[model samples]
Target chain A: MTDRWDLSTRLIEPAPDLLVAQPGRIVELAGMAGMGLTRIGYRMLSEASRRSPMAVVDVRGWASPAAAWEAGIDRDNLVIVRCAESSTWGQLVAALCEGVPTVYAEVPSAVRDRDLRRLAALIRARQVRVVLRPLRGELPGGIAHLRIRAVGVVWEGAEVGHGRLTHRRLVLEASGKGAAGMVRQIEVEDAGEDAVHVVSGVVSRASGRAG
Target chain B: MWFPAWSLGRPDAPAEGAVLVVDTKAGVVACSGVDSDVGPGMPRRQAEALCPDATVLIRDIGEEARRFEPVVCQVEELIPRVEVIEPGKLLIPVTGAVKYYGGEPEVVELLQGKMTAAGHDVRLGLADGPFAAEWAARIAEPGTPLVIEDTRRFLSTLDVGTLSGHDDIVSVFRWLGVTTLGSLADLPREAIASRFGAEGLDVHRLAHGQDRVVGPRPIPPELAVEATYEDPLESLDQLAFAAKATAARLMVGLHREGMSPFRVTTELEAADGTVRSRVWRSMSPFSESALADRVWWQARAWVDTGVIPGGVVRIRLDPSDLSGAGRQLGMFEDVMSQVEAERAFARAQAIVGPEAVLQAQPQGGRLPTEQVDWRQWGEPESKPERSTDDPWPGATPSPAPALIPPRPTRFEVEWEGGIPTRVRLGTRWEPVTTWAGPWRLTGRWWRDEESVDRYQIVTSAGAFLCTVGSDGTFLAGIYD
Candidate 1:
């Protein structure tokens, strides 16, 4: 029943109209995933800072799998690691916050049943949205996020208007790895906890509910 | 004895527009067409056409009020209840002014002396009614006051043009065979009203010696706020007071219209006739305190830097193009916090240099890195980082660097199959991942000699790194 609810049928790709606040078409810049996280995440985080002086993180160097609980930061506002080349599929799944609409770069690797449930918990508790790409490094035994995919995004009839959904700053769901989330939907702007609740809960509801 | 009204487009002026000013009482004064400066005392139309290069600055009621505010202040110091028509005109209800300044002519002389010293060509006129006084001022001799003792007799000899209001009045007068105020006066007031409407009745009243204030003119409570300086403001402290007063008055005036200015234009009129103006813009529409703070900061910046001198004779704060309530905040905000980023930036700019503060912008380009220009905050910074994100397609997942040093690094390359087989990473020729090859990089080759070819390789030392140019592959970056 749980697998049916979130059958991993869709590939975790960057949301099309990535700028769009709603969970619309999930697709990534085709070639970007291969470029690795350390190179791109830094620039994106810095760019987001200039857009609206919020926070940024670089989680590609998670060092090892257990770094998540050990990484000493506010659990609520952690940005997920985005270094696809470094992080495994299992590591990325552990990073995602279930149903929370927090932004993540990509699932780390082919996650196990327990790790997937962990990702689902984050989604349910915090509303996480991972901008995962299907591309893998062109290596003999390269681990690709696209290998273990999710169902394609369901846009339904999301109307484009200025509302709660479009105004939320992204909650970066860092799986023990330290990837930073880039919040550019840029609404409901106050830089602390109140802002995050509005971002994840209210904005998620608005985007989730809009026809 | 005429004032030259310059609207720079008159014939004597260049192809560029000139100035035009008209003196009503002088019968005729020199008119310089927008381009022409035809001496003095010329007809308006002729002067305008003669130069054909002048642009006419119409009588700005507000500007006139502003220009004459100092004169009013000076007179207000010497008299009470000064009536202002503005734009080079005023009336001192002299029945009391005469008593205060030792009779009419002497008061007129004192007023004239003050205005003359203040650098104005003043004409004094005395009469019971405001209209009569103004008319007398216009026609009064250069050094003489035009005293219209008998209002009726004095006005009777005046030409019909003096009735000067609407075409309807002129047409009605033509029908009634009344060319002058003298003929108009002969008509009964009741009859003029019944025949030509209330305005004609007004004309008949004006024609008679019975023109009263007629219920104080409906002053728009003030359409704008203006301030005048007693002395040239040579210090930011002095400008602060003037700026505060102007902003407070402006905000109050706009409050009536339920609006505020997001962008305000400050026009600094220099003593030597140079007008320095600039518009200050903000992301969120500001409060009066915030605006004044910005203005003070702007003035401080101007003072700190030598943009404007301490010798600013007059500073006019104009809230032009004000917006309504609830304007949404812009993306690149000017730090709504108390930290005041723009002020700091301005200070940093002034002290170090204007171009000292810079922002990293990503613009569209193909080079491993395309564009990065210096910008200040609150300005929309362009994002060119995406193009550089993954510039190469099949090059073994080589993530490119956002910033490259000034010179292109040289490297020694060895190939396996068609891909770059080996690269001299830091010191020695190291074996490379043969699968991902050919990181095509093309930049200012014509401009510089450092055009590059990149390769993403998993080295024998077990490092996944991006290598560029046969120059020196100094750990462009590592992946897993």
Candidate 2:
């Protein structure tokens, strides 16, 4: 019989290829309200939830569970905390990082610098992946390991009084420590029936940007 | 023992002759001061129709459990280890008590006398096992005690429907012509196991009067968590805080040992050397929050009824009935990490209010908002009111909007030839380049709600899911 019970001989590796941001690091999805930041965030959360339990800190009560389900996140393994106050965002996110492998939180309007440093240290210690969605265009300083900005979007399968929005192509630019300088164009097709496909690849690299 | 009409018999229940009915979302759970036509499990509306003047109140389980604490305390004076099955029902091994009190009749008489003196009407039953004893109690009169000498023979005479908590299995047995416990017990054990699997085997054992023996394993002295206060805790808040910490420590210790306790003893000592303790039982292993809730319930009951003489000085928790940790993780689940996360979530719940921390499960609804059910963290997940299996005709097609505003945001739409040309978004006008129309959504017409036309519009800025109703155009959500 095979030694199935012997865990000491098992090879363990952190899932690096799953997301652009590495474990124990902060990844920011910065954009305006309707610029598809939440869409990208949900996609990342979906991938993260496949590996371990994940949490979402909805500051403005804008995290839609239905959309998240459509985006392929495991509803059973997800916990959504609705917190409107900005002052407690640091403590709440840190608390979530302790239990969940991935903590996807909406950045409040203003975050104190002390909270950022505390969160960064805790993430390193716990090896928890943190994804920050700054929908109102306010970005935290210096702590983010990688920042993916939504530059533009192109809606497909729709025209003047014609078909519905079956799919769309999103343009994302990645920078900071993790990605250096890479631009990726991804196609997010929502073909009804609770199915969504994200075809993504690195399309190009920026010339002057440096980590 | 069983206390009939427990829900309607609370100290704060409505006065007699009021025809009170306690109900939940499902239906009427209990009733009192009413006729047989208004029985439990009947729909609330039908029960109300039967007794027109009845007072209907929602069931408060916590209140029922809290009120039952006094009876539990009364029984504890004679029996050391009383296992409470629910607010109305409890079990205690009578071998030692019977010997101490001289006989079965004497023990029952003593228990009945004590409870009656305390103004509680209870039924006592003495038998070989809990199942038989409970049925005996159910059939016994208020003062009279039911004692069964032969457990198997007594159980054999009862209908198979008497098997509580296994309704589906019992129904199947009834369908298969096994109508009585006698018939079920006569069936081959191996055949029962082959037909019904493990659950059937359990039923077969119960039919033969072989119910599980309530023998709580002796816990290690080191596993007991205790905290002594320098100053006696004067307030309920102080006691609750202490209980939370003590429960957490006990849970951590149990988790480390890869064991969980199904039975726990909560003991509190007063400043005047007065001691009170209660044994709490759970069908599954007790989590940190659950154990803490039990301690709080017991403490509040004692304080509210003036049973505790003075400020409490010490709080201790002793866990028994140890079993392998009941948490069965999935193939890819990391146990240590999951445990750590659960502890962290508990901490987070404390930081924010418990109500603020929520978990979502998919439910049925046409609108995106109604498709998900949100429950507070740590509470058992309830079945959705509507199942997703139903074909909701007017339901929104996937993918759902990423951002649903707490309330719909009104927007001014500029139209050209009945098509939206531009939309006013937060003091700026953005021209809509492409659009999809008017998925007509009708509200529950019986409630007199108006219908609306929902549109999906893609502007230069981003995508918007808006509704155009008689009132005006409102931004329902953003496809961000």
Q: Write the per-residue lDDT of candidate 2 for residues B49-143, one digit (tens) a residue.
A: 78887877777666777788878877888987898767778888788998898999899889888878877778888898778899889888888
Model 1 has a DockQ score of 0.04
Interface RMSD of each candidate, angstroms, one decimal: 18.3, 6.3
Q: Give a tens-digit lDDT track for model 2, residues A105-171.
A: 9988688767878888898888887888864664656778778777766666667666677666555
Top model number, lDDT: 2
Q: Residue B27 in candidate 1 has what lDDT?
A: 14
Q: Which residue pairs clash in candidate 2?
A: A36-B480, A99-B341
lDDT of 1 by residue, B1-480 (tens): 112232222234345435555542221233333343465456555665675655543333233333444556577788765543323455566777777668776887787777678766667877766556667777887666677778888777776677544555787677767887788888787887888765666667777856532332222435346665656677766776566556666665655555556556666665565665545544335556556655565555455455565456666666544532323334544323212223323333333332323334333344322333334323333333344465543322212232233333444566545455666645666665332434456555776756555444444332233445545553333331
Off by over 4 Å in 2: A1-21, A157-163, A181-204, A207-211, B9-12, B16-29, B33-66, B102-106, B113-118, B121-128, B131-209, B212-218, B307-310, B324-327
Candidate 2 chain B least-lDDT 10 residues: B17-26
lDDT value for model 1:
0.42
